[model samples]
Target: MCIIFFHFNPNSASAYRLILAANRDEFYSRPSKPADFWANNGNILSGLDMEKGREGGTWLGISKKGKCAALTNYLQPVINMDALGRGYLVPNFLTQDMDGLTYLKKISLEGHLYNGFNLLTVDFSNTKGDMMCYYGNRSDQEPRVLDPGIYGLCNSLLDTPWKKLVNGKKLFTETIKKSCALSPENLTQELLNMLNNEEYQLPVTDIEEQGQDFIRPILEEFSALFIRTSFYGTRTNTVILVDAKGHVTFTERCLLKPDTNQWKVSSYQFELET
Candidate 1:
């Protein structure tokens, strides 16, 4: 997930406890499977990154046991290709038995094993209460629990207030307010519409301003909520809503072919098994 907008209302008496919308940007040629329950585990639901030799990894995923995780790469001028693929972070948390805090601590200890990335993990099955934790290896902050509120993340640190993240949060808040009384399908459509927005343009940050001039065009293309380029762009848009009753609605819209305008959508609903 390259960009995400979410609201986490753990204490809400309303219909939903969590609502999330995200876009996954990647190279068009990279192969991936659409969102579905894993054939092996059955309990895990996510799209699989089928890039060569890095199968079984995912950018976002949720378990039947009320665990969910999503990851986004942190912006860096250089990346360590020899490090672990960050896609595995989501499924690793989803399949594990640890709570959000414990699992994040574990990841923190071995953060150097992976490239720079931001990770969000949730364990709604906690006996005390649901928990959400966020960690970014590139950040100076430690893994910390998030309070109930709206948040946004992209290639930057969590809630960095990039132009796109700020605008996305506003749109997301509006969609949630308008969809309070709508049906699940209607709400999903509204969120999808929000993700399709591409008007916001990112200003050159201090780092990008100092970088070489040749990279500016690529950053300009990436500024939109919905990015499109000949070789790389937003490949998937996903919406996940979990109600107060532990019912989950997951919907994914994916590009049907590389560098094409066609898209395919898949949706799933399941009650949490807690």
Candidate 2:
């Protein structure tokens, strides 16, 4: 499962803020267009072109309106055919005008035929921005809303408190609650702290703790031998921020190669007319 955290603050230049950190075994598939999967003429928007038959997943992106979104895959037991590809949700949220509840209800009915996945979409373009969560039917409940601040979202549930996303939550909470002042520059520093933290250590103490405990076991079990696979490991850690003014910044980290320590950072900043 992957993890996503976002901040919604209307007073800042960018009405919304977002940070996405995800850990996957690797992606070994072809590429596809956002529209080929679904159409999102809505408020939020984001997409990644699948490299022909090579598949890739996106963290999240914003739209011309004041919307933002992210998604994660569920790694639980289920029929293979039951899983629904969520490549369309990001772009849908970015481009669609549908608010939280409206989109939830519509997607619920549309997803009845599919299996596992989760999407978190937020729109602050209205008088007050709102947030919502959508899960495959087996989650035992209906879609729900999220509060403003840092949150941990994984495949299992909202704020799953898993290893990869826990430390980020802690840092974000402290920055907002304890800092005397906050700004885009400070937020970017906090993000870098998480990415540069010991990549080889355990993320948490135990299953009950809000961190990762099975670090050793997972590495031992999976890194037994080196094999050639057309997979992209941890490509980049992205950080996005949208203050009240509709300004946004996107930063990405490009790793050297598999099992390497070097990395490169690239950033993009833009503003919307909202």
Candidate 3:
């Protein structure tokens, strides 16, 4: 996932506990399967990254056991192509029985083995209560439980206040506040529409402002929520809503034909098995 905007309100007396929308940006040539129940692990509901060496991994996913995870790469000039595929982090958490904190601690030890990335893990099955933890290998901050509130994550640390993240968060917060009276389907559509935003602005930091000469143009090209290029762009838009009563709704819109605007949408609804 390149960009994510979410509201985590576990203490809310409202109908929903979590509301999330994310866009997965990648090369159009990278093969991927749309969101579906994995055949190897029926408990997992997520789209598969079919790229060679990264098969079976996902950018975001949820398990029937009430575990959810999402990952975003940390933007930098250098990437270790030989490093472990960060995409596997999501499925590794969802498929395990470990609590979010334990799993994060374990991963933190080997975090250096992979490219820099940010991970968000949630364990709704916790006996104490649902907990969300954010950890980034490139960050000095330890994996800590997040307080209930709105959050945004992109190609940086959590809530980094990047130009895109700042604007996206504002729009997301507004849509969420107005969604109190909307049905699940309508809310999902509204979030999807928000992901289609294509506005761009200057980078928020000097580091972000200075991109590698080779990829600098590509970097600036994706400053918007929705990015489109001949070879690379946002491949999918995903929206997930988990209600206070444990009802879950997951929807994904995948670009069927890149550069042609053709899209295929898949949706699933189920109750958390906690």
Candidate 4:
């Protein structure tokens, strides 16, 4: 949602990997983690509250069934609803092992009576591998199969104009390019370098859009402010995938937290050796 990080082809043994960390005041009102969570979901999974019988704030989730998904709220005010439309997506993804596209089709056809929201679903269960983001509103923009590079998508449409999304993406892209130019051997470190670069150091901004001043209270809650100054927006999200040998890794960091430098909140390391 606010912060999204990933690597398309990192030249590793894993096929794909992703880690998601997000912050939201809305999660407080929702339910907590699921009971017998391991039985239904994978060994690694995370989520917040929002569903009818479930909670929200799903930073990241990975199922033993090989299904994975991470959720974040986009920073937009015009797309408001009583509840995030189909807010139950995260829990459903964790508990149910359905094909990604099949699931998306059903949700798209069935309308919702709640607030509008966006979702990124990853399905690697079969050869039909893909990643998708949805806007539960009039926008018919279907999910996008993520490319093999560093990408950031907040709430304002994929590849928006927000400083973090825009600038972050630039740094992320250049980091990878420069690394490739040096030598392909630094693939791992190169990928990490992109996620760990310091040149992206710029004080956060309280970026206000065309006509959302009145909604400052809501916007301020999730906009990017310097980690040292605020915790309203996405700190950082990193993902890496290598298909040649079937290995993957992903990590997300809470940049606002002063006490921790360990980023990979939710991660998966495995080989789909079928």
TM-score of each: 0.95, 0.70, 0.95, 0.62
What is the C-alpha lDDT profile of model 1 across 66-182, one tens digit per residue? 899999987766668799888888998888888888888899999988878999998885356888999999877889999988999888788887777788888999988876799
Q: Flag clash pairs in model 3.
A: none
Report the number of the highest-TM-score candidate.
3
Candidate lDDT scores, in order, read 0.86, 0.52, 0.86, 0.46
Q: For candidate 4, lDDT tens digit of each residue in 34-143?
A: 21134333454443443564444364555545566655554444554455434466667656657655666666665354444455666553354444433333346654
Q: Candidate 4: deviation at residue 244, Å? A: 3.3
Q: How many residue pairs collide in each prediction?
A: 0, 35, 0, 26
Which sequence of candidate numbers ranks them by lDDT, best first? 3, 1, 2, 4
lDDT by residue for model 3 over 106-146, one digit each (tens)?
Answer: 99999999988999998775246788899999987778899
Which is superior by lDDT, 2 or 4?
Answer: 2
Lowest lDDT 10-mer window, candidate 4?
225-234
Clashing pairs in 1: none
